[model samples]
Target: MTATPPLSAQVAVVTGAARGVGAALARNLARRGAKVALVGLEPEELKAVAAQCGPDATAWEADVTDVEALTGLAERIKAHYGRIDTVVANAGIALGGPLLDSDHRAFSRVIEVNLLGSVATARAFLPALAESRGYLLQIASLAALTPAPLMSAYCASKSGVEAFAHAIRAEVAHQGVKVGVGYLSWTDTDMVRGADEDAVLKQMRSRLPWPANKTYPLEPAVDRLAAGIARRSAHVYAQAWLRGMQPVRWVLPSLIAAVGSRDVARLAPRLAATAASRLRPVGAGGAADTAARSDRSDRD
Candidate 1:
């Protein structure tokens, strides 16, 4: 009999696989011998990521926010792979600006994609995961732990996913479907780079304390995520220091409020002077999400 690969004969589904953490994680899992299903709105980018994931990988274009599309995609993925041993709900977008000045639609879109989209992903794939006794990893962020100024939408969405994943973990435990929440600090992704383009936003991030302000390399961080997937960890921290923050999480909001308020006050004028258009979603992935929504609206 042929010996199985190190990570097992697993089939993994990754949403937002077109770029950043999602794309990197898909490639890492594929390297470990998992057949990957790459899902996202950018068909061509998803195709490119799928190619990097090798022959056993395939790309599917679908919006994570659309329950019908995701449910159908889940069915097709299960049919194509025969089983889905892992599902990574990593699709998300970020919009950075003061809440008062932010575009209402852009702010809401962040919540829809990052939080509700995660819910939709879980709803669609839980059945397949339960059947395989598989793992579901929800990609949250440092924003979830420490609320920051100018990132209300992103923070709220990440925090929501973290809570949502925790609640479902209890509900689905008997089915043997393990749910894990993955957290990342600032990483060298398109989203981060996009946010850095605006001097005021960049300055606000830089003002953050110590290691939390640093932008980490993507590969090593993703390698840790792959390890977490293998172990089915309850909480996976891309940066080591993040795990330490958990014990003190309850105090973070107060701390951030004290510190971030000063920074926001100092930056407020500059932020207000910045063009309204520049306050929109932060990266190419975010741009694609906006365009796709526009297209959908046009169709409607």
Candidate 2:
């Protein structure tokens, strides 16, 4: 394998840095000598992550959906670091259930955070990235390429961000800004565990194809992400198999639909009943009880 460039004295801003993939990524970046700024809503958790990341790492609490707050954070980090070298718009949320059974408010909120929030992060950090000829990494999901039932909002948001990243790449490449989109299968993250807590959802996911059904360990994925960022990769896949899936993406949706149709048909009623009470948006904290709660309106 080729060696990654050193990140000593470079500045990296990672949203959703309190836990899960975000937390791990920040630490990994720090190990490579990047001064990381952890941004999320969970103050205590963020502080802990920063502490582990070392003295140069700082915690900045802000909701990804809050455009003004994110913009201010960018300015603050730039002021403190002198220049920003990389940005990882990794903050995202997941909501699952049958469309009819899902809360419209929660559905909108997912899009607001996972999709628009990524856009805001990119917009907020673009100037600094451009100035330094830096890299921007958007964390998407396998859901973006392979749509799943009972996860309408997540599929939509991840799909949107993937497209957003592609479009943004075209716009920013001329300015020497490199853009990358990350695709992950089910990993051992709080978000996956939260979704699995619903028995019906768990059953449905278990029926998925081989590797997709497996929840891979978190460390390997984060390690690859760190390496990808160091190399300014155009696309990053947490699992090696996912790389092959990209070129054949056009046929994946149909294949998944065909295979998943039976599972959805069997679990539809249970999904509706269980999703309303059990499905919580994955956020700052690893699990539902501690995850950030959402308001009824996206305007909030």
The alpha-carbon RMSD values of the candidates against the true structure, listed in the order shown, are 4.5, 4.0
Q: Candidate 2 — which residues are off by over 4 angstroms?
A: 1-5, 278-280, 284-300
Query: On residues 240-259, what C-alpha lDDT tens digit does candidate 2 reach at each position?
Result: 89898788889988887888
What are the per-residue Cα lDDT tens digits for candidate 1 across 184-217?
A: 9988877677667778988887888898888999
Evaluate model 2: give its lDDT: 0.80
- Candidate 1 structure lDDT: 0.82
lDDT for each candidate structure: 0.82, 0.80
Error of 2 at 73 (Å): 1.1
Residue 128 C-alpha lDDT in model 1: 96
Specify the poorest-scoring 10-residue window by lDDT in model 2: 291-300
